[model samples]
Target: MKVRLGFVANSLSLWDASPAKTITYKRYTELPKEERMDRLQEVTRLNLEHTKRILYLCAAHEIELYRLSSSLVPLATHPEVEWDFHTPFKKEWRELGDLIKKFGIRASFHPNQFTLFTSPRQHVTDNAVKDMVYHYRMLEYMGIEDHSVINIHIGGSYGDKEETLGRFHENLKVLPTHVKEIMTLENDDKTYTVEETLAVCQKENIPMVLDIHHHEANLSERPLEDYLEAIFATWEKRDLVPKIHISSPKSEKAFRSHADLVDAGFVEGFFKTLKTFDQDVDFMIEAKHKDLAMLKLIEDLSTIRGVKRISGGALEW
Candidate 1:
């Protein structure tokens, strides 16, 4: 089994390189009318510059998987804000895509929790569609929309799983077919289990991004191994390797929270189980330490017998 490892947005190893800097709506409204656009442009420019720097860092380190910060453009999906984020940064967007293609990075976006289709409210569903379009537009601007994916959770049950899931299917119809084609759903830490999420993915003909941490916290009646093959099979049609989220708990008391770093021991069994399939997978580390945690996990896993450090961010066993 070979695994390519990556981390979420921002790199602790790099100073002031956060791609998620933003201005709240209140702050935007507070700014003088003349300065609001300037402020947005300034923050977005910095975010994009920082993102490019981080991409360079990834390329240097052979890190091939990365989650783009959804907040790359401030107030991008705000109901009142109207700005052309793409026109101003056309070259920047293309540069990022060029670097990603050159380095063979599997770029993706995970919209915030609010971007969901399970809501009963019409406005919530409308906003979800707007948010999805915003993310898709970023990918489009980068010229990577065809290959890159936008991942999101199945969303809240809203006092009823079956009804909410039904509503989710109904609400999801509002999304454009092209955007929906590249969408992948993930299992959440509280609401959806792997089995449930997998079933939904299968029903909708969508890929699934499994989060082991969420599965560990909210387990299904059956072991994860029971659904592992099916979960992976969901990606076969997409022609992309299955992507998994990896993170250890903060502590026994805070089992749902991510730790600063991944403990190989905590996920050793998962590795063992995955090895049986002998499939290559990409792992997105969701630890608090970001890139540092991804590197540390790779180091820790490389020490295990039969595991080879294939690259700065990959391992084969």
Candidate 2:
């Protein structure tokens, strides 16, 4: 069995390297009309450059999995301020893509919680579609739409789980088929459980990203072992490996909150269950410490008797 570990956006190890820097709508409006576009472009350029630097850092350290910041382009999906973010930075986008391909990095995007299809309101669904298109455009510009995925949750139940799920299926029709092809559904820390999310994924033929932390906070009726195989099977038809999210709780009381770093001991049992399947998987660390937590977990896991440190971000057992 092999596991490739990665972290979310913003490396704590790097100074001033956040790829999610942004300007508020209020602040944007405060700028002089003529300088609005310039300001947006300037912030986007810095974010992109920071992302490029992070990619270089990952490549140097043999970290092949990365989640791109969804805020790469400021006000990208803002109804009042939609703008062409690609034309001005065509070369920059291509360069990022080139580096990703060259280094074999598994890139992805996770839109904010609001970017979901289970909403009861039509405008919310419209906003969801628009948000998805924005993420798709980023991957398209990078020429990685075919391989990269855009992950999102099933969304709020809206006081009715069954009805909302039905509405979710119905609302999803608005998304383009090509965009849906690379989409994956994840079991959130609230609202949806693994079984519910997995059933939806199976029916929709979409991949499921198991977030173990969320699973612990919000469990299914059956033990994870019972559906572990099915969860991994969801990725069999996809081009990429099955991916999971990893994080430790903040405390016993605040179990749903992510801690500063991953507690290797806390996830030992989950690793044991995964080892039973003997399949390769990718772990996206959601710890607040980001890359540092991923590296620390890798080091901790490598100490196990049968586990080998294959790379800075990968382990084999």
In terms of lDDT, model 1 sits at: 0.93
lDDT per residue (tens digit) for residues 1-317 in model 2 = 98999988899889999999999999999999999999999999999999999999999889999999999999998888999999999999999999999999999999999999998889999999999999999999998888899999999988999999999999999999988999999998889999999999999999999999999999999999898889889998785789999999999999999999999998989998889899899999999999999999999989988999998889999
Q: How do the residues 177-200 of candidate 1 rate in per-residue lDDT, one tens digit apiece?
A: 999999999998999999899989
Give the Cα lDDT of each candidate.
0.93, 0.94
Report the Cα lDDT for residue 208, model 1.
96
Backbone clashes in each candidate structure, one number apiece? 0, 0
Q: Where in model 2 is the C-alpha error above 4 Å? A: none
